[model samples]
Target: MLCLYNFIRTTGTLKKQPVYVWMWFTGFIFFLITYLESYLWLIPYFRNNIVNDLTIQWKSYGSMVGSWNMLIYGCGIYLMDKISGTQTYSYSKTGFAIYFLGLFNLMFNWGHHIYTVPTHGYIKHVSYLVSMTELLLLGRIIFLWRRQMKQNKKHIHQPGFRFYAAADFWIFLTLVLAIAMSIPAINVYTHGTHITVAHTMGATIGINTFLLLAVVFDQLNPLIRKIKNFHRYLLPGFRICNISLFIFWISLIVAGIMKAWWQVHRPEVPFSTMMISLRPYFMMFMITGVTLTAGMWMMLLPVVKQYFMHGMHAKKRMELLYKKRNASLSTY
Candidate 1:
């Protein structure tokens, strides 16, 4: 609510703000609605009905998740514009159309999550179409954005720019997985498997995490520069995290494929047996997860420590000034 209020105050009116601003505002509004909708299952009136069951399934699966994606994507667009020194408030008509379509997609895309559930055929078809359209539109936007960048201004904030680039790569990778999973035929096998987990993790860690780190590094640019030998950690950490994440992602996909194959061809096999078969992939991803964690801490720890140290120094200065003022008053 406070965020919405501040956003509205800053933008003043939606008509004047850029397309990304609208995306962010819509995200904030819809996120609240979907979050509340998630809890509707707790209400007696909404419980024990086909409609409510479908609603819960959809909400649990993707609607709220999509809302937050909107917020992150919006921020990403804004950052891209800022970093490239292309703060053009003007948007093409196609951009506006895509934005509106994205709003519609966010509302209806939840249907894909309910495919296994008994529901209208139109719901599934519409969702599949909408999801594809959104991905294509996003790809187009990224293509255009990349083309618009005339020169690398990355020297201004190298870490931030590199993280943003990493996010773009991950977006492409995750979109491939997302598009594949959206296919009803493919979804049948992958829906509840680790493929779904892979898709979510790719989006969360690959795209969202990198984009957020870009923002964080941009904000901490000065502090980062002040820290001695920061590059030692940053360079290795960045490489390690990306490499580990790629391995982790592939491991999940391999496990999901194996699991799905077993389920389809060897339905008579017990769940424990199938899991035993997946143990190698599980071990591979687990080790990579640890490496990923270590990489993140290496990159983040120095900046965080510097930030708190600066804060403490500022507090001490204020305290000394206060004490001096008190002594001056006493002299008078």
Candidate 2:
């Protein structure tokens, strides 16, 4: 559907677009097929088969996740192009390099997730190496992006740009944690630990979700600017939502670390005892979740209402105009 929309809006074939477009288009196609296979075949196959080894299951699941990342990364490309006001930005060699690296990770880097499975040692090591490369590539991308943003500081703090920047920060932080966890020596301790949970949480909440939201707010920014006092609400809402999310995110990391430490270093400790120890972090997560939710509701509620009302009223006006035109035509 996305590709179809792009084709409809474009002057020519999708092949005429930049390299990143092809990368994402292929990913989108695969994502649809993967989703179908997962629902129609994979789940039932797993259920009926009494498979002892979970290596295939876990590894495939990880790659499936990587598959969806294509959509997110594609959105990131679109958002970046929109923000920078450049059509060819995604075709730059640097951008092409990142896209291929992302494609590599999508297909292969998922091996790290199965390090704990009874897989070959070399497989795990190779995955670790491939996983590390993502961090370097992402870091370079962000460094160059930030340098550009610095040169154009006037637009840096715009609501959409702010969300993009926040996503970059989250990407950096998640990559660091992921790199640390990818070390086989460290994975021995962190696998199946809260630390692993932290990595997933950061990637989902910090990077993908943030970037998607940035795109949403960005597309809405023009409409918002036309309304009086919208920025007054939106600016503060952005701050509150981001602040609460950071707290929510960090709290998970803290909880994950504590859980991993007690599980490994104090194996004699009861799980209940560990849960009791982790109660504060859980409480913090709950509080921040509420704050984040409330802040988002407050921020988006008015905008959503206005959007719907405008659409409906516009439709009615068009309908009335069409009726009047028909009546005049009948009289003529």
Candidate 3:
């Protein structure tokens, strides 16, 4: 938030970076829907309803948010055409591969969100099928990307950042998350506790946490800091966030295990409440209020902004300031 304010204070054309614009638009929609769901779920109105009712509402609003997000996100990625050879796309083939993968991913999400509607049974089945299929395709995309990165024996970069080593981490996490999410019959095989919560946390930590860490590592490269000659202070910022996410994931994992083990607890209460009622040692801070939320937000805050705004706003402002100074000097 502070960074955004400072960025806006300076002056420059933000340009027609459609990818940046779409990313921010998607993120803005994400924030709004998340905010609404968080508040709405807490209210008593939807509490007593069947899972289907809650699911329906979620799907309705989620579809609205996601459809527009897809359009903008696709536009942004397409706009990357100008940055083909640069760090933005790495190479033409690599960039197209990524763009297609992203396009398909959005379509899959759209299908999945609409699948379970009460009006259509066949639509639901098709949606379910595509969801898992997209997961496998996503896994393959990561694999190909990693292969390309290795075969090239080189990496891409931008000013103030040049660490492609983190791409490996990104690919690995995406695979892990895809596998975890694609598990069929998970709900039926589960002994107790809702299958959804565990799946949600697993994806959140497995994918979200790793992606955040990858960005931080790409920026800081602490593992090879001695040889890299980068600023040492940035290491602490990345480290703090990485450790925070690790702890959060570990805590969520432990809580899930306990929930599965203690089958007698009622599902009416929130997961946080149930985890606290378990009274497990690890569950103390991990399952409670603020900790998980703060950790997840910490990871997301930077990645979300970086993707959407890309710190490029600050750069744009700096360029404008430089141009203004040059113009003033010319007056003499």
In model 1, what is the error at residue 319, expressed in angstroms?
1.3
lDDT of each prediction vs. the true structure? 0.83, 0.75, 0.46
Q: Is 1 or 3 the stronger prediction by lDDT?
A: 1
lDDT of 3 by residue, 37-126 (tens): 545555666666655455645554544544444443343333333223443552345554544554444434433443323445654465
Off by over 4 Å in 3: 1-55, 61-120, 136-138, 145-171, 188-230, 261-332
Against the true structure, candidate 1 reaches a TM-score of 0.92
Clashing pairs in 3: 18-76, 19-76
| Full-model lDDT, candidate 1 | 0.83
TM-score on alpha carbons, each prediction: 0.92, 0.87, 0.48
Candidate 1 lDDT, 24-48, residue by residue in tens: 9999998888888877777777787
Range of the 10 consecutive residues with the lowest summed lDDT in candidate 1: 148-157
Q: Please provide, for model 2 over 150-265, each residue's C-alpha lDDT reduced to its tens digit, 9 standing for 90 to 100.
A: 84486665567766777777877888888888787887777776677768877887788778878887888866666677767777877788788888878888888887788779
Model 3 residue 237 CA deviation in Å: 3.0
Stretches of model 1 off by over 4 angstroms after superposition: 89-98, 138-157
RMSD of 3: 9.8
lDDT at residue 89 of model 1 (Cα atoms): 39
| Candidate scoring better on TM-score of 2 and 3 | 2
